[model samples]
Target: MSVWDGIVGQEPTVNLLKSVVASPGSGRDDIAQSWLICGPPGSGRSNLARAFAAALISPDQGLSDQPTRVTSQVLAGSHPDVTILSTNKVTIGIDQVRDLIVTSEQMPTTAPWRVIIIEDVDRMLERTTNVLLKEIEEPAPHTIWLLCAPSAQDVLPTIRSRTRVVNLAVPSNTAVADFLIRQEGVDRATALKAARLAQGHIGVARLYATDRQVLADRDELVIGLLGLRRSSDAIILAGRMVDDAKSQAARAVEGQVARAESEFRQVNGLGTDERIPPALRGAYHALGGKDEVRRRTTRLTRDVLDRYLNILASVYRDVCVLQNQADETAGLVNLENRPAITDLSVRLTRRAAIDRLETIATARRRLAGNGSPLLVFEALFCRLLVSDR
Candidate 1:
């Protein structure tokens, strides 16, 4: 019934946050003005931070009212008093951090506090974080900073020491299924299947439930591994995967680029398809509006590749579960691919399955380290080739 309702399987954290908002600045040194929310992917860390920011901005009526328009603005990241740096770029540049520091110094215009949220503080390079540590340590009385990362260890010790850490667990399968059903109006069967396939990732579960094509694509990718008997076949499959991931990334970027362009046009009172005059073209470049499209494309491609690799890893996870004779209801991730799971389990021993998992993990690391996708995936698939006789 509260704004925290959007957050799943985080009751203790929710209660702690509620208590904080209810009793702020009562000489409780434990209640921190700076927070670092750490969690696995798809655990809703960003959303939870937004809810907390909404409450901070309007503590008196925020939690109780389930977020009025002002708080909704906070969630949408459009509130005047709330500054969110949710970058899709690989690295959080120094300029963005400097801007946030300036914003943090500003007094709340219409809310109780000026809340600054950095979605992936771990993405910042060392020099950029050094530019922020001092400001984060001594913030204005009305300022609050909320930072998010995959885990506390991902951040530097100095940065970690200056903030209160909140760790979130991966949501349970039943919890994710229920969330999908409630949020997406999906039937129990669909919800359960997506929940299992997503391995308790709420956002991924929602995508699996609503998008038949997404489900089919993942299933096909897993099934394709069975047909890669030759090295050439593996290379071909890797190319297809790279192409698909890029296409998905491009589709994702198109909408965002369109929105940015639309805003650019609206700001200058130009028609949708109208050409910008030569003078105004420089203004667009000055705003970095011209480069945004390339940035969006680059960012989303990296993200899509990461996700595709995770999906590939999950296939081996399923095979491992089957080989071990684990609890079917709870342990299996790809329920719809049970046939493929069973087949892979029969083809590969437990050791072989685990080896493939390690291969996938290595591939992920290499990709993160800026390895070429076609090469990485080809190498991964060759290692993952069904060789257990």
Candidate 2:
């Protein structure tokens, strides 16, 4: 398949990138070296970046004779000349940027250009962005950087000014559903529900279609939120949400950390329970990569919490739609939760639903600012309780 085949609803972007890849030096200078791909969550920013990388590494021969091996290798991240830095951490540290900068200085070993992709560039701290500024501004002639962020504004203005911007919009529900049906062999009904529920997020729609448990959990969360009839119930539900998020986050990373630790021990010639003697402890610690693991865990936990909040927010949004008798054309994010939405709309005033949504937004802001999730959710629950009453 072509590198651009799977990217939905980005025909113009695909065409632009394809032309550049076909005749690299013929494109506008602005589109050559450094690119900032901006899109909302699930808009396939990273997918587009990888596609461009694949096309870049493929033989310069015409698109008809594209090197499938190079494209596959780039997609699978096995390409020696293409490096991807995708972090689950809260911030990309200065050390990470420095290492990437060092990599960028090296000439391409095999491909025509050395491509470095940094996904979620918005997650990098201001100081870390500053550290990367000079390297991105003055990269080696053979080096290219592809950075992905939710928006151009999310990146520092100086960095934003230096990179060519590619913006991707959310795909239509029909496009998402068609993709699921064609790619994953999902039935049309299931695909439509998943696509509608995911609000055009292809990844999430696939998950909703393939994972029955995810669909069930979303239903439970939506129904439970709507049925919160008392303050104690709100508090209990809030705690459950936080606990569930933490548990999911821990489960998500537990196996990854175990594998990393096992590989670290094997490389160090140590048993699972072995402890290094004082003299060799420095080497052992150096191999641990413990700080990186902890950082990933923290970041994953926060992300899971954010996802939980997003689900709640979607349910409330559905409530708003139902309360206003919004037309089907407006669409519902939680399509499967329509019964719950309708019930809540009838049982609660429109103002209460709006207030609850506001409370959730405030909780998200507090969480973003690194406030304690428990306190933030507790306050949110209190506010929601008061509003419902």
Candidate 3:
């Protein structure tokens, strides 16, 4: 199968990268060593970047013709000439950027070129990006940088101008559903419903299709928000919402940290729960042992909070659609909650639903900007309280 398989609805960007591989130097932009791939969440920017890296590293220089061994190596990010950096932290710091700069200067060891693929490049600190700008302005001949971000505007304009930017489109519901069917083996009915609810995010669509608990949790969050009748109840429920998200984020990363620590312990011939000597511990903390985990947990917590806010917004979004549309069945994101959404729509004006959506959006931005989660949600929940009058 082609490396691009399962990357839903990004044909133009895929073809552009393929052409770059097959016929380099045809255009200055075509073979540019540094490139930016930008798209919304679930647009497969990382997938495309890795696939392009694989094709570029392969001798055949084509997606379909890339040898299985070479393809697997690049995809797994184990290829000697390729470097992949993906951080779960909130921001990529100066030290990480400096290390990447050093790697970028190295000559290719085996493949014709050295490829570095960094996900979430926009999350790099501005100071760190300034440091990276010097190297990007004069990158080595055999080095190629593929940076993935949500948008060009997310990074500094100086960095944006230095790299060729490729934008990916959000896949359609039909395309997403089709991918679910082919990849996840879900039935067409489940696929379509999940695709609609996920709002064009392939990753979210997959979770919606495959996991019953996701839908249940989403329903609970949506219903809890809508059922708030008193200001006191809203504030109380808000606390629970914050706790739920933080808990989920904690559970999600605990295993990753555990596995990594286990492997490191095994390599150092230490048993599980064994304390290390002070000298050896230096190396461990230097590699971001406890500090990095704290940062990752914070980031994951914000991610879960964002998802909670998004799910709440979807309910109002459906409410707004039902209030405005000629046909109530069309254009609803949360089809599973139609009965409640329909009832809520009848109780509130269209303006009220829109206002609540705006409130949720504000909470989301505040959370991302490092606002205290409990306070933000408390304020948001109180504001979202529907009046009986």
Q: Which candidate leads the pack in lDDT? A: 3
Off by over 4 Å in 1: 24-30, 59-61, 258-290
Distance from true location, Cα of 118 in model 3, Å: 2.2
**Better candidate by lDDT, 1 or 2:** 1
- lDDT measured at residue 242 in model 2 versus the true structure, 0 to 100: 75
The digit string of per-residue lDDT tens for model 3 on 189-283 reads: 99999898888888888978987866676777877876889988888888887887777666767767777667678879998878987878976
lDDT of 2 by residue, 31-104 (tens): 46999999988889999999899887777422443547778888877798999998766678789889999999
Candidate 1's TM-score reads 0.89
TM-score of each: 0.89, 0.84, 0.86
- lDDT string, candidate 1, 303-354, tens digits: 7678777887888887877777774554766666678678878988888888
Clashes of 2: 0
Better of 1 and 3 by TM-score: 1
Report the number of clashing residue pairs per model. 0, 0, 0
lDDT pick, better of 2 and 3: 3
Q: How far is 211's C-alpha from truth in model 1 (Å)?
A: 2.4
Residue 359 displacement in candidate 2 (angstroms)? 2.1
